[model samples]
Target chain A: SQKIEQNSEALNIQEGKTATLTCNYTNYSPAYLQWYRQDPGRGPVFLLLIRENEKEKRKERLKVTFDTTLKQSLFHITASQPADSATYLCAYNAGNMFTFGGGTRLMVKP
Target chain B: NAGVTQTPKFRVLKTGQSMTLLCAQDMNHEYMYWYRQDPGMGLRLIHYSVGEGTTAKGEVPDGYNVSRLKKQNFLLGLESAAPSQTSVYFCASRSQGTGELFFGEGSRLTVL
Candidate 1:
């Protein structure tokens, strides 16, 4: 069975610093990978999507890199602010089946 | 536009009680899904519908049943609730050829 793993521990970073979160998968590669931002008590909002053929993708201060060789994807937030605090989830779509990781909570402290 | 809407934002059920969760999407999407989220467990797909009157089981479909009588509506039912069923339920939909999913506010269920 395919499995997605994200750091369950909360990540604390100083405001203005770069925050990086990781998502790793096992079993097989996916057609695409996605990152979503989830605030407390709210549904997740799509942030970025990177295809298996694309090495990197960027939107504003956010960037996502997919390393199919490593079966990993890294999500980065540059010049992070306190408002950027939230849980980040990583998901992959294979044959139209989407699988999500447990997500990593991020806290940007001032 | 209300991309996706889920009824009964929250519910509390006793063991063995039965209830249903409703999901509606106005996007006219071809795909809709039901998922459950538990602490540190991520989101597990329970069931999904690809079109009106068509349904399929997902990763965690056990103990749950679904219906897609209408293209805009998907229903999830629990005939006999259990404590292990307690989790936040989310309904999402995506259009054909798109991988992005639009999610609802979520429905929190607690089985005591």
Candidate 2:
């Protein structure tokens, strides 16, 4: 079975600092990987998607890097603010199926 | 536009009772999914349909059933509700050739 391991269950970071989250997977090679942000009482919103062939993708203050060799993906939020606090989920797209990691909760303190 | 809509935003059921959650999408997406969100468990896939009349089991399909009779509508059924089934349910749709999933607000189900 494919397993996705996220760095931590929860992380606390100071505002304006860069927050980095890690996701590592094993036993499967995904065609693409996706990142999502989910606030409390809400469904997850898509943040970014990086294909296996793509090294990195960026949008605004968010950046995602996919390393197929290490079977890992890193998500970074630069100059983070309190509003950036939420649970982040990483998903692996194995052909027609999609699997999600447990998610990491991030708290940005002002 | 209402990208994806889930009916019965909140529902409560006694053990062994049965009910269904409705999900509709206006985007004409070919793939529809049913997922359950539990505290600390992220989201678990229940069942999904690649197209109308096609349903496939997902990671956590044991206690749930799904049907996609129309391209825009997908239904999830709980034959015998259990306390373990108490969780927020989300419906999502995706167009072919895209990796992004548009999700409904979600249905909060509480099985007592």
Candidate 3:
């Protein structure tokens, strides 16, 4: 069975500071990884996707890096705002199969 | 556009009760999936469909059955539910190649 692990359960950062979260996988080499934002009581919203061939991807204030060798992916939210607080999930995809991490709840405080 | 919608946003089911969760997508996607989210355990795939009339079991498919007779709708059924089945269910759809999933608001189920 494939396992996805997020390094932290929760992360707190001062507003305007960069927040970084990690996702590590074991026993699989996914072709691509995805990142999503999930608010309390709400389903997750897709944020970004990085392919195995691609090392990094960025969108607005968000960036994701995939290291197939390390079996890890790092998600970063730059110039974080209070509104950026939410649980972020990392997912890996193999063919049509998908696996998700437990997610890291991020809190950006002013 | 109502990318994806799940019916019965919340429900409480007694043990052994049976119910179906409906998922509808107007995006005309080719793939649909059902997932359950529990505390500290992200979303686990229960079942998924690659296309109409095709369904497959996912990582956590036990105690659940799914049907996708229509391209736009996928139904997840809980036959004889149990307390351990309590979790927030989400229905999602994605186009053929994008890999970007559009999720519904989620259906919260509490089994007693």
Candidate 4:
């Protein structure tokens, strides 16, 4: 069985700083991984997706890196703002199965 | 365009009660899924459908049943609700090749 693990602790960062979150998997490498932003009382919204063949992908101020050798994916939000505070989740697709991590709550303080 | 819509935004059910959660999508997607979210736990897949009239069990399919008779609607049912079934349910749909899921607002269910 594949397992996705994310830091359960809340990450606090000063506004305008870079926030990095980690997602580790224990099992076979997935074909692709995705990051989602979930605000309180709302469903998750897709932020970025990186394939196994790709080392990194960027969308505006958001970037995601997938390291198959390390079995980890790192999500970085550059120049983060107060409005960027939300729970970030990482999910992967392996064997056509999608599994999600527990998610890391990000708090960007002004 | 109502990408994915879930009915009964909030529901309260007693133990042994039965109810169904409705999910509708207008994007003409080929894949649909049902997941439940709990505190300290990430979203757990309950059931999924690859296409109309096809359904398969996901990671956590216990205590739930699903039907996808139509291409645009997927139904999740609880034959006998239990306290452990209390959680937020989300419905999602995605196209064939995109692999990006479009989720509904969510349906919060409480069982006592």
Which candidate number maximizes DockQ?
A: 3
The DockQ values of the predictions, listed in order, are: 0.81, 0.75, 0.85, 0.81
Candidate 2 docking category?
medium
Instruction: Name the DockQ score for candidate 1.
Output: 0.81
Q: Which stretches of candidate 2 lie over 4 Å from their true place?
A: none
Quote the lDDT for B89 in model 2.
98
TM-score of chain B of each: 0.97, 0.97, 0.98, 0.98
Please, what are the lDDT tens digits per residue for candidate 3 over residues A1-68? 67889966579999999999999999877888999999998889999999989999999999999888
Query: What residue runs in model 4 are displaced by over 4 Å at the alpha carbon?
Result: none
Candidate 1 off by > 4 Å: none
lDDT of 4 at B52: 96
Estimate the lDDT of model 1. 0.93
Pairs clashing within candidate 4: none
Candidate 3's C-alpha runs over 4 A off are none
Which pairs clash in the backbone of model 1? none
- Error (Å) of candidate 2 at residue A62 is 0.8
- Per-residue lDDT tens digits for candidate 4, residues A1-110, read 78899999999999999999999999888889999999988989988989999999999999999999999999999999999999999998765557899999999999
Tens digit of lDDT per residue, candidate 2, span A1-110? Answer: 78887865689999999999999999766888899998888888889999889999999999999988898999999999999999999998766667789899999999
The TM-score, computed over Cα atoms with residue i paired to residue i, of candidate 1 is 0.97
Candidate 3 or 1, higher DockQ: 3
